[model samples]
Target: MTSTPSLPDPAGAGQPIVLPANGTTVAAEDLQARFVHAADANADMTIDASQVENVGQAMLQLLVAARAHAQAEGLHFAINAPSEAFLARVAACRLGEPLGLEMEKEREQ
Candidate 1:
């Protein structure tokens, strides 16, 4: 069975971009594009990664860059309900801080 990927809604502030289940390098470009579009449209953004089953360094880098860009623009960027796989990859890559993820809570979740 095939599942449709959840696409981000580029509308108002605090809009959430739900990450795909496979968060590897293959999805980095698309994810980056969506993240940019959402962040630009909204002053505050939430990225829901609860379905992520895999993660790659490239994806992590994109997220870090997006967070940095948002901060520079004085916008709020938050990762909501990150999956265990996503959290593990972030911890392995030491990108928790750059991505503004609360590691302790992430582990607990």
Candidate 2:
């Protein structure tokens, strides 16, 4: 339903940050807000995309914005495994390059 879902504490660790449900335009703003909130709170943040059900440009934007926001906040940012179903779209979006290799490496861990 929403890309960002609802506000929750990243708290550095405890739960895998998830981008649940289908990503849509309406969810982008919330996603950005959550990312900023995360950056503000966590010294480092891990985004788990293993539960990402669907994705779109909005989703891409969310990740990109989150990366930038987290970086600006001086927080380490990483993404868990992204679903294979949307990997192609993620690549095509041309935002993956900016997402860094962290997601891949994290997936391996």
Candidate 3:
């Protein structure tokens, strides 16, 4: 017997989706749907990366795209309370500025 992973309901604007520990290609589709829903709502979109321990290019790309969509729509988008692993991964990919990781670090100071 096989079971399909359940799709998550779209989180309301300003509400964050706490990312799972694995932010890999397998998770990109679900994440994309959530971002699309948030964009369609025409409100702020926030993602909590506090639980992200392992991340991949697909996830990072998805986040960048989501942020761009929010910006183009004149809505706020933020990634809150990111874990060290998440931070390092963004930096390693040279996406700190685009992903707002650099700004987030400054805010913590």
Candidate 4:
């Protein structure tokens, strides 16, 4: 049987959640859990996507939802140090605004 994707532990207050290099559908559940944990902490959360090499729509949706949840709960949510691949996929999927990611071209600068 294939092993489930492992997610990193939640960081402490004001820390960033470093996303897995492959942020695809395979890790959707894990990603969701992480986001929930961070959001429920009622503190600022920074999602680091510097290592994301592969991503899918599910992951994008989760990020969007997490961002909204954080907003509703009065928590700060931000995406930091996004990888080129990650930005490209966000742009391709038109999730930049929802995911709070800068456009690929803009982020490349």
Candidate 5:
């Protein structure tokens, strides 16, 4: 008897992130490290949420913090490739507009 794994509902609970093959993964550890690097280098960073899943509340906080850090340094911050599921989370949490996530990037632009 084999049990199948369940796909977590985006609204059900928080899930850990799966880093993408390219681009920086915005998981907890990376979020912290990136924040420091940006602070030291005074550069803005983008988070690609399209290939990301299993997002938890902590991850969201990290993004918020990153934006704040960038703003403090007068840097430009942006989010690209946010999946619908992830976008829903931001809307549900009322953070989409504040985060400046216009919407997910369209393919074949």
Candidate 6:
């Protein structure tokens, strides 16, 4: 199943921004738009990365930017239910710290 980004609403305030299984450049636009929508609404951003199997640099960069944007806006940004592949790709790119991925473990506790 292809993941689609969801806009935050009162009824879905904590809904996550779901990432497509193939996190390549093709999905970057949709991802960015999702981030923009969340930022525009001054909402906290949560990413659902469980579907991500193969993520490319473009998608990774967008994620980093999204985190920075959320931080600058004083909003929380987190990834939930990340898949092993997603974690490994972020680690392979040495972006675990930047993406606040290690914090996921902390949050689970």
Model 1 spans > 4 angstroms off? 1-14, 39-42, 105-109
lDDT of each: 0.78, 0.67, 0.80, 0.78, 0.61, 0.82
Q: Which stretches of candidate 2 lie over 4 Å from their true place?
A: 1-8, 11-14, 102-109
Question: How many backbone clashes does every candidate have?
Answer: 0, 0, 0, 0, 1, 0
TM-score of each candidate structure, all chains considered together: 0.77, 0.69, 0.81, 0.78, 0.64, 0.80
Query: Which wins on TM-score, candidate 3 or candidate 6?
Result: 3
Q: How high a TM-score does candidate 3 get?
A: 0.81
Per-residue error for 94 in candidate 3, Å, reads: 0.6
Residue 18 accuracy (lDDT) in model 2: 72
Q: What RMSD, rounded to one decimal, does every model reach?
A: 7.4, 7.7, 6.0, 6.7, 13.5, 7.7
lDDT of 6 by residue, 39-108 (tens): 7888888889999999999999999998998888898889889998898788777788788888454333
Highest TM-score scorer: 3
lDDT tens digits, residue span 1-109, model 5: 9999964332123222333432333456655665566556666566667865456666777778877877878987777777766776777776775677764432112
- Model 3 pairs whose backbones collide: none
Task: Encode model 2's per-residue lDDT on 1-109: one tens digit a residue.
Answer: 6586655665335565677667777766666666667666764668777766677687777788777877777777777787764565565555566776423433343
**TM-score-better candidate, 4 vs 5:** 4
Give the alpha carbon lDDT tens digit for every residue of 1-106 in model 4.
Answer: 9999854445555568778888778788876777777765565778888999998878888888988988888877899988889988887777887877657564
The C-alpha stretches of model 4 lying farther than 4 A from their native spots are: 1-10, 104-109
- What value does the lDDT take at residue 108 in candidate 2? 40
Best by lDDT: 6
Model 5: clashing residue pairs? 15-54
Rate residue 105 of model 6 by lDDT.
Answer: 48
